[model samples]
Target: MFSRLWPVMRKEFIHIRRDPRTLVVMFIAPLMQLILLGYAATTDVRDVPLAVFDQDRTSASRDLVEAFVASGQFAVAHYTGSDRELAALIDGGRARAGLIIPPGYAADVQGRRGAQVVFVLDGSDPSIAGSSLSAARLIGQAKSVSIQTERRGATAPLLEVRTRVWYNPDMASAVFMIPGLIGLVLQLQATLLTSSAIVRERERGTIEQLIITPIRSFELILGKILPYALVALLITLEVLILGTFWFGVPIKGDVGLLLAISCLFLLSTLSIGLLISTVANTQQEAFLLTFLTLLPSVFLSGFIYPVAAMPAALQFISGIIPLTYYLIVVRGIVIKGVDASTLLPQIGALALFGAILIVAATARFRKRLD
Candidate 1:
């Protein structure tokens, strides 16, 4: 088996070495994506542009504006004299949120009637809008509490809620996103490389050579996969190093366990690609098919969006995606540092996916060869 497999594997390595573009896609592209996406794909909304219309012109109103700025959640991008100007700022996208302090805000607070301030948020992007709204509420509540305490001559608050964040204390989005990015990049490259593998052989008329050889179908499949699997593993290692040292995302679990699970993930992805190669007569078709699978995997696999939030139908689709299970495992190992026992269910799912996909891909490839 090794004797027959060695040639195919060696030939693949030779092809990869000769193709500079493949080398770049395998190594350089992932790192570039990791760096670019790591910074770009963040959920922490800080310094949101704020437009303020202070009608009161009092110390209380000025203090409210200062509070928003000092909290680091908002920056006063425009100070407007009228409601029209504030509305214009929001319409022009210069401000994500608007604060309007009514004329009697100070008097209302002083009279113990409770001041009312209007906070207008741009509802175009719900994520940004929601975050800005939450922050605004918190700032407003804190400011109101301070004013109340001062008026009552109280040194301590009547109620204080202490909160602690676990796993990701700072709540850095990169810490949450990098592990998932690792899985995404790995699946992308592995599937693309293998999806084109058999198609490339057919396009170059090399499939005939493969067909005529005494190489059994299983041996051929193993040979086609092993080399790309190694390449995928190397890419995984490179991105892991970059994600950890460059992005400062710590690996809390056993690195060996992570790599082991990564291998299982590669098995599923490679087989899916091989299956694509068998179905697609041309490289373009294979590429298209790979993306068709990838798009749903990305959006529905709880990568950027929570799977639980997806509708039942979409959630069902996510369940079949190997990336979904792999992501749970990757995030578990990388971020939460859960033990093997804790990850047994995800591990078992990956193992099952790899088994089913590889077997199906082998059958399809063998049928095509015959």
Candidate 2:
């Protein structure tokens, strides 16, 4: 057993040393991605595009609008005259939030009658909307307190806030992040594993011998896939263990279901790699193609950005990426404690993607053999 794997392992090492792309994918990419995205991609929504409709146009109203901009959470993108125009800005995707100051000639505040300001948020993206809504509330409350202070000889009422959080009450960022990270890692590993397998063989001029061997196409493909699949599984288990033991991410739901569905997700990624290997002639070409696929899959997969926030075109593109369904499934099961029945739609989607890609890869592999 040692002798057999030693040669195979030695050959893989030679390939890795010879190919810079493989080395980057295997080692540099994972750590670099964790650090880069951990810092860059965040839910702390700021610099949100805001449309203001100051009907009264008084100093008071303008001051309120300025307060929003000064918070650094909102940037005034448009000053609209009519409610219709303000609505259009948000509807047309030009702005993420809209503010309306009712016309009272600024007398209401002076008369000590608290006025109401309407905040309209585009509800497409929940994450951005959450931050924007919080900012709006805080600004409104602060303004109310200031107005009261000015009128009542600098005395203000005491206010206390009681917060109750559900579903991850500890607010562990790890609990929210680890499942998605696992999905990302699985996709990267599975795709890179299978993507280079055949291409590397061809690059080393071993395809002729592989073709002449007394092995059917199915056998050859399975033998190639099983080893890489095992490798991907090991990486996933490592991530799970580190996440649970080191990061303290709780498994609130069915771990068995998580593992089962994860395997289904791998099928699509592995098949994508196999298809790339079948088409690509050079190891460099294979590496480039794999990265090309990997980049968009991560971006559009709702891994970092919410899919609802993306344009209609991109949302449609994301529907086809296997990682998208897997993220929903895994995150739902792990954090939300949702059952398999609740996730049937995502499960079916993953199954369909896996079936289609594996069939296509098999057909291509057979054609290459013939």
Candidate 3:
């Protein structure tokens, strides 16, 4: 068994070594994805366009305006004299938030009297605008507290923080997603598609011609995956560059470690694809099966939501999905800049997944041939 497997593995390696494009994909794909996703997909909300209507134009109103600017949450992009003007600014997409300081605003605040600041937010695209609202409200509440403390000499209202996000600071949703997409596109395209490559030849009566000669299944698998893998890798690079340059995402992590982990992830996904190919009767079947597996890897893998946020049962189920661990590894390396030593669990899980996939694929391939 060992002897037969070595020959096949060696042939596969040789075929892969000879393909330049596939080599590039195997090596360069992850980097590109990191760049694209990092920049395009962000959780941090900043520079929201704002319209202000200051009725009093007093020192307090001025101070409040300054606070909005300094908070880095809003840019005073427009100023309006009336409520209608504020509405117009928002309607024209010139502003996301509007502030209306009521009459006697400064006097009411200073006299330990409560004053109201009307804030109008564009509920359309609430994710971004909502974040701006939360930040602005926090700042306003802080100012109100200061005013009350100054007048009353000590009874300040309790502060309650309600945090909201725009893109993905904690979810790092882009970081988690892009890397997984790399695995998905490459593995399905390369593995399952290639799995049928040799079998299709057999179905077409050409495989026997090669089989009677010197060629092997391993060589065929290599030839099939190499070109597709390269394409996948190039896509990865495109994603990374776009994320970094176009979006201004910081690549403050270890590139080398990221690449290493990506390789493992690719290997596992590819193996599963290969395993599917062995069982599938046609390309359509293989495609369907790949999608069946892919859906679970995606929706169930905690790509869009937190595993911890999921029920305990679902979280446990997600533990077995290879992409789930890979998501953690890639996001951790890219966003948090975690090193290999610290990411041991994720790395270990990937390694184990790869081994299992490879073993299962090899077994299926042997049985299919038999």
Candidate 4:
């Protein structure tokens, strides 16, 4: 049995080793992807440019303006004299946020009447805007507490909720996103790229020559995937190593278990790609189909959004998406220091999905070739 498999494996190794382009892509491509996706996916928004339109330059108004600046969320990029100036500051991309304190604002605070601060936010980039808004709310609440304390001559409420975030203490989006990117790059590049390569061979009429020979269908699939798998796996490793070293992220999990889970994910994704190739008549179809699957996976996989937050129907639908499980496993292992035993359900699910994909792909592939 081992001897029979060796010939097929050797044939794959040769095809991969012979192509220098494949070698470069297999190693370098993943590293490049890591840098691009990791940096872009970060949620820590800072240095938000802000324009202040203070009609009343009173001490209280200045104090309110100071509160916004002190939160480290926004920098006072411009101080505008009128609404038109503030509008231009936002329209010209000079500021992401604008604050307008109405005249008589200081009088309202002094008279114990609640004052409303008009905040104009650039809602185009929701992630950055969200962080800025949260910070602004905190600053406003702090100012309100100070005013109430001074006016009432009484201490503020003693009750406060203590919230602690484990694993991802800062709730850094990169912490969760980098690992998912590993799965995405591997799945998209290895599966779709290799799938297209196989389809290309068939479209060019070269597959008939191989089919007539002694090469088995499984061998052909292996030949198509082995090189791509190596590339995807190498990229996954690059993301893990580089992300840990450069980003100060700790891989606080069992290394062996992480590797095992990663192998399962790569195998599953590659197989799904192969399945697409078997069904597709052209490389174009394969690529489109792969992306069509990839987009929904990215959105619904709980990579950016919490699964619990989604509706029950969508959550049920999410169970079928491999990235959902892959992200959970990766985040669990990388951030939470989880082990294989603790993640048996996810491991089992990945294995089942991989098996089904490979078997289905192999069956359909043989039919297509025949």
Best by lDDT: 1
Q: What is the C-alpha RMSD of each candidate to the true structure, in Å?
A: 15.0, 10.1, 17.4, 16.2
Q: What is the TM-score of each predicted model, taking all chains together? A: 0.60, 0.61, 0.53, 0.58
- Return the lDDT, model 3, position 89: 62
Cα lDDT for residue 151, candidate 4: 80
Where's the lowest-lDDT run of ten residues in candidate 1?
Answer: 156-165
Clashes in candidate 2: how many?
A: 0
| Residue lDDT tens for model 4, 123-216 | 4334555677678767777888877877885354211112222355465667766776777777778778777888898899998887888878
Whichever of 1 and 4 has more TM-score, that candidate is: 1
Best model number under TM-score: 2
Off by over 4 Å in 2: 1-163, 367-370
User: Residue 257's C-alpha lDDT in candidate 1?
Assistant: 93
Cα-based lDDT for every prediction: 0.77, 0.76, 0.65, 0.72
Task: Give the Cα-based TM-score of candidate 3 against the true structure.
Answer: 0.53
Show the lowest summed lDDT stretch of 10 residues, model 4.
Answer: 157-166
Ranking by lDDT: 1, 2, 4, 3
Runs with alpha carbons beyond 4 Å of true place in candidate 3: 1-154, 157-180, 214-227, 367-370
Per-residue C-alpha lDDT of model 1 across residues 1-370, encoded as one tens digit per residue: 9999999999999977876544544465456445434433445667878888899999988988999899987999988999888766654445767888888878877777677788887643344556777788788779878887778954433222122233565557777678888789989999999989889988998889888888888998889889999998888889889999999989988888989999999999999999888777678667767766677677767687655345566668778989988887787778767677767778898999999999888878772443
